[model samples]
Target: MTDQPAIELNNGVRIPQLGFGTFQVDSDETQRIVETALEAGYRHIDTAAGYYNEDGVGAALKASGLARDDVFLTTKLRNGDQGHDSALAAFEASRKALDVDVVDLYLIHWPTPTRWLAPETWRAFEKLLADGAVRAIGVSNFLPHHLGRLLETAGVTPAVNQFEIHPTHQQPAVQDASRAAGIAVEAYAPIGKGEDLSEEAVEAIAQAHDVSPAQVVIRWHLQQGRIVIPKSATPERIRSNIDVFGFELTTGQLDALTGLERANRLFPNPDEFEASQFRD
Candidate 1:
């Protein structure tokens, strides 16, 4: 219901370009923190089953009195649940935990390429879409090669491909591939885990714009037409993260940020990562 900018999905569904990410937000504190974000005008909330906070997300949404349609909610299937039937069952568990009959978006938390089950997982995603359980479907931390394989048998091209992108980790090849495949590229760690913000280029731009380094970085993402999910549990930070629509980064500044790319990746490589490691 807000005039906030959004991008149309491949299926014609409009998704708010900016979202609040609850990646490491503690489940015990998720309700209060999420309520603050909701009150700060963030309509999009992204949580994964692995985050263990979907119930809190549901509580906050219910307590806010916003209609189910007023907010856009996204949750992902965990890595342990990657097979065909298991993926479908995992989605239902997420839906129940979130207390929502329909999820705005659903994603595979990771490609888990070592398991060799991404294609099969995607098949279940297609079924969820067909059954009207999820408005849109996507994948997180997938590289171009993983997507190339999925495309071979995919009935529906992924609506979005979320990655660990920032001024430092540009991932141009993956971004370009997503664009070419008609999939929206989403920046997961858009601020570069607080490392790139201290760079000379980001600092100079922030001083010129009279905003924080994080805001300048976020603004850069918006200008480039990438969906950004910046996570913060503090009330002030949560509010500041979504208050980025007012400014624009200059072309020179944008290029300067782009030049900061050094192929610095912060998270685990999807191909080598497995869910069992986290479980134990």
Candidate 2:
């Protein structure tokens, strides 16, 4: 625990560089997976209302026997909950679902450009921060333009911007902008959803380091100062994902992985994905 690295946020909050992601994890199995991650020494957990597993996450946390403050819990407001009032309501609902009094980080799940209510949603986030309901606030799947709009109207700059980032789709431009703004960039699907792990370049790097392809990718993210949340339900894979602090990637190996970037986005582009108009 002492050797693990943490990234400091603009607000001075410290987050563990390596986190466990609960995206696509079934609600029924989320508790067991989360427990496994905790047992494996993962203190940060990322989930979302859209994932519909907050309760499961909460159950695992309660059962872990660790103090509430020992863990960093993050969840997001769903797309439908994008307006000021609804966003506020949704935040409370998420808190309730998680069975926690407060969340360490809260985020706008997606920038619903079609609904065009991100600004309103941001206002709700501001209130949450002001009221101490959330210690940090951020956005996910937000583009540069979306972040610009948020900065222009937000009283507090987002502490983090989470998006799909992997060896195949390293968002350099987005990462640059986030760095310039002092906003931490968090990588979701950092292993390329198990697609690029077998690529020649990643495999070669893994061979050089005598580690798994996933370890090489995660190490790449840590070396670049980006926060990574890789998801896995298997006990061995979950344990393996966080075993990256033992080794470091050389500059050449890091550059090779960087060169593998091809802008191959796995998730929908927020700019083009028409956000569902249903407001809950």
Which number leads on TM-score?
1
Could you give candidate 2's per-residue lDDT for residues 1-31 as a string of tens digits?
A: 3247888898988888899999989999999
Q: Write candidate 1's Cα lDDT for 1-280 as tens digits.
A: 5779999999999999999999889999999999999999999999989999999999999999999898999999898889899999999989999999999999988888878788889999999999999999998888889999999989999999998999999999999999999999999989988899999999999899888999999999999999999999889989998888788988999999999989999999887888742355
- Candidate 1 stretches greater than 4 Å from native: none
- Model 1, residue 22: displacement in angstroms? 0.3
Each model's TM-score? 0.98, 0.97
lDDT of each: 0.91, 0.90
Candidate No. with top lDDT: 1
> What's the CA error at residue 162 for candidate 2, in Å?
0.3
Clashes of each: 0, 0
